[model samples]
Target: MEKIVIIGGGFAGLNLVKRLDPEKYRISLVDRNNFHCFPPLFYQIASSGLVSANICFPFRREIKKMKNVSYHMGHVKQIDIAAKKVTTSYETLEYDRLIIAAGSTNNYFGMENLAEETFGIKTVAEAAHTRDEILDRLERGAICHDPERRRRLLTFLVVGGGPSGVEIAGAIGEMKKYILSKEYPELKPDDVTVTLIEAAPQLLGAMKKKSRDRAVKDLESLMVNVRLNTGLKSYENKYVTFADGHKEYYETLIWTAGVKGEPIPGLPPETIGRGNRIIVDEYNRVKGYEDSIMAVGDIALMQCEAYPNGHPQMAQPAIQQARNLAKNLNKGEFRHKFEYLDKGSMATIGKNRAVADLKGFSFSGFFAWLTWLFIHLISILGMRNKLSVMVNWFWNYLFYSTSLRLLLRPTRFPLRKHWGD
Candidate 1:
């Protein structure tokens, strides 16, 4: 049996592992974290709609069912293509075949301050941290006697117009509309603000024009300030300067602006393409070593006639590519070319407002919101997670509140005296 090593236990890697024939290949999965986190629901975690465990699954528990698979908790330091070896933080492993699915990281567009200060919802930990920060800021704002300082603490800015940005902005808006008055009685409804800024012409650039229009309308209805063609120039000392030379004071800034592939070291510079993704052929094989080394998911860029710029870095594309690569690897031959199926896009704005574009048809309103909920709930991995998320959603829908709004932090205590003393 051939020894196969896969890096990153993301949507792509997990799907690929499940499809591969375990009896014919011994597989080892490596990741910095020992859990697989669902990125789509990360915003929910950040907004206190869900807990971390609802979307995260332990890798060891998942791999136990596969007799031929083992889990390694470590970060990939380098990949030696010629030697066919993967060097992790813990140890080195030799593989007959290697798969790269390391995924992407937040792109700050060379803005150091934004990268350092802004909150991100890319991982479970980050999302949880963001939630705590938001809650902490609210708590401070409620007690702040100075009007200016309190205003700054109450203002929330989300930079990005994509699904992640829209969803999070909407979630925050919902909290302001429903939860703020009851929980933080000191702060009035008009005192809190949720602003969403998009540098592009419209939000959800990939979606249909109708959907984009609907998203903007829904967000505005929720009292969210939607700014278009607005770019961030700088963020310093709790103040944000826009490209138009205007400045605003805000304590909370959530950045879902962009993401770039985090390619592992030791690959030839020429193999790296736009967005720092490894250039791969249609068969999902690395440029130089098409036979042994393969790249899939967000880390790989395979351009075709339909997608000259490469497939959109999304969950569907990543999952599809992994399944396709697994089939080809199982056959021991790169017989088929990878074809991406565009399954359309959807984004929810608030309680009963959402937009969905399926093929050529577009819809918005409560029905679209229901569709969005159903799809995401079904796509989540693990039955327990699905049920937990469902219960949370149901409870939130009925009460307009959630019990998961918790600001978790480590507790420190003073040293205690010995029992003998």
Candidate 2:
């Protein structure tokens, strides 16, 4: 049996393992974390809409049934292409074939200070921290008599018009309307402000124009302040300065603006392309490489006529590419080139409101919202997760409440027994 090594247990990598026959290949899956997190529903975690365990699936449990599949939780430090070896924190791995599926990271675009000052929701840990900060700020703001500090703590600003930003902003808006109204009556509905600032003229720039308009309308209905044509110039503690000389104050700025490929070291510079992705051929094999090495998911830039640059860094393209490559590998010859099928895109804006562009036909409102819910429920990894999410959604809908609004703080920040008495 040939030995195969795959790095980064993301959507692309996990699916690749599923397609491969363990008996035919000795597979080793490596990742920094032991579990795989669903990225699409990360906003719900950040807004206390869903728990972390509801979206996480352990790879150990997943690969236990496979006889030849092994899981290693280690940080991959380098990939030696010439030697066909991978160096990690625990040990080194030599393989007959290698697949690099390492995903992208938050791209600050040379804004070092902005990256430090803002919050992001790219991972489960990041989403948990965002939730913690939100709960902490709300608790502190409720007791503060100082108007300036209270207002600053209550104001939530999100930078980006993309799906992550839109979803998070909408979740926060709904959180304030439903959760805060019942739990923290001391804080009025007008006390919390959810503002979404985008540099583009409209939101959801990737979706159709009609869907974009519907999203804007839906967001407006939720009382979310949509700021368009606004660019971020600088950010400091509790203050954001815009390009137009306007300044805003907020305790946290959820930066969902952009991301770039997370390429490993020890690879030649020529193998890298725009957006830090590794350029690959039609069969998802790295350029200039024969067939020993391949790249897939967000890190692979496979250019074609329809997508001259590359396909979108999305779940569908990544999953499809992984499955395609696995099929060709199983055939022992490069028989199929990857072709993307755009299944359509959708984004939810609060309860019973969403916009979807399905095969160029645009729709919004209740029907779109139902479609969004159904699709996401089926996309989740395990049955337990789907059921947990569904139960939470139903409970929330019934009483307009979410029970997972707990502030988890570090031990260093110990609470006083009697309000610092």
Candidate 3:
């Protein structure tokens, strides 16, 4: 059996592993983390609507049924293409076929200071940290004596008008409206501010005009301050300076602005394309390599007539590309070209409010919200996770609140003295 080494256990790599024939190939999957995360619902985790475990599934448990597959928990340090060896943090492995699916990282656009200070929801840990930061600020704000400090502590700013930004902003807005006053009686609804800033002219740039308009309206209705055509120039000492020269004080800055491909080291510089993605052909084969090496998901930028630039870096495109590549590998030949199927785009604002742009038409309001819920619910990996999410959602919908607000902090135990001490 040929050895197949795949990096990343995200949507692309995980799907590809599942599709590949166990008898024909020996598969090894490497990732920094030991579990797969549902990124779309990360905002819910940040907002205390769902916990991290609700969306994350262990890789070992997932691949246990596959006889030919093994999971390695480590980060890929470098890839030696000529020798066909992958050097990870823990071990070095040789492969007959190498697949790169290392997804993406938060793009701070050279703003290093902002990157360090701001919270990002790109990963499970980041989402948990964001939730903790928000709650911490709220607790501090409740007892703060200084008026300005208290105001800043209560103010939350989300940069980026895309789906992640919109969803998180809306979630925070809903929290401020429905949960804040009840949970923290010291802080009124008016004390908290949820602001969403978009550099673009409108929110949800990929969606239709109607959907974008609906999103803005819904956000505004939820008491979120939507700021369009506003770009962040700098962030210093809890103050964000806009491109327009105006500055605003914010305690928390959640950056959902952009994501660049998390390309592995050792690849030729020329192969790296826009957004740091590895340029590939229609068959998802990496540039300069014939068939032994390939890249899929957000890391691969395959240009075509339909997508002249490249397919949108989304879950659907990643899964589709992975499936296509898996089929070709299983056949022992590259018979099919990867073509992206643009399913649709959807963003949920708050309860009974969402926007969905489907194939034939676009819609907003309660039905769109339901469609969003149903689609995400079914797309989740594990049955137990799905049930847990469903239960959490049902409870939240019925009570207009969630009880998963406990701040999960690391327990710091005192160091035990040695026998001599």
For 1-421, candidate 3 gives per-residue lDDT tens digits of 9999999999999999999999999999999898999999999999999999999999999989888999998888899989999998879999999999999999988897876899989999899999998888888888988877788779999999999999999999998888877788888788888999999999999999999999999999989999999999989999999999998898899999999999589999988999999999999998888678899999999988888878988999999999999999999999998878899999999899999999989999999999999999998989999999999999999997678988877555675433111
What is each predicted model's overall lDDT from 0 to 1? 0.90, 0.88, 0.92
Report how far residue 359 has shifted in candidate 2, in Å: 2.0
TM-score order of candidates, best first?
Answer: 3, 1, 2
- Cα error of candidate 1 at position 406, Å: 0.9
Report the C-alpha lDDT of model 2 over 227-258, residue by residue, as the tens digit: 99998888876778898988878778899998
For model 1, what is the error of residue 300's alpha carbon versus the real structure, in angstroms, after optimal superposition?
1.1
lDDT by residue for model 1 (379-413), tens: 88789999999999999999987878888974556
Q: Give the TM-score of candidate 2.
A: 0.95
Question: RMSD, model 2, all Cα superposed?
Answer: 4.3
| Top lDDT hit | 3
How many times do residue backbones clash in model 3? 0
lDDT for 269 in candidate 1 is 92
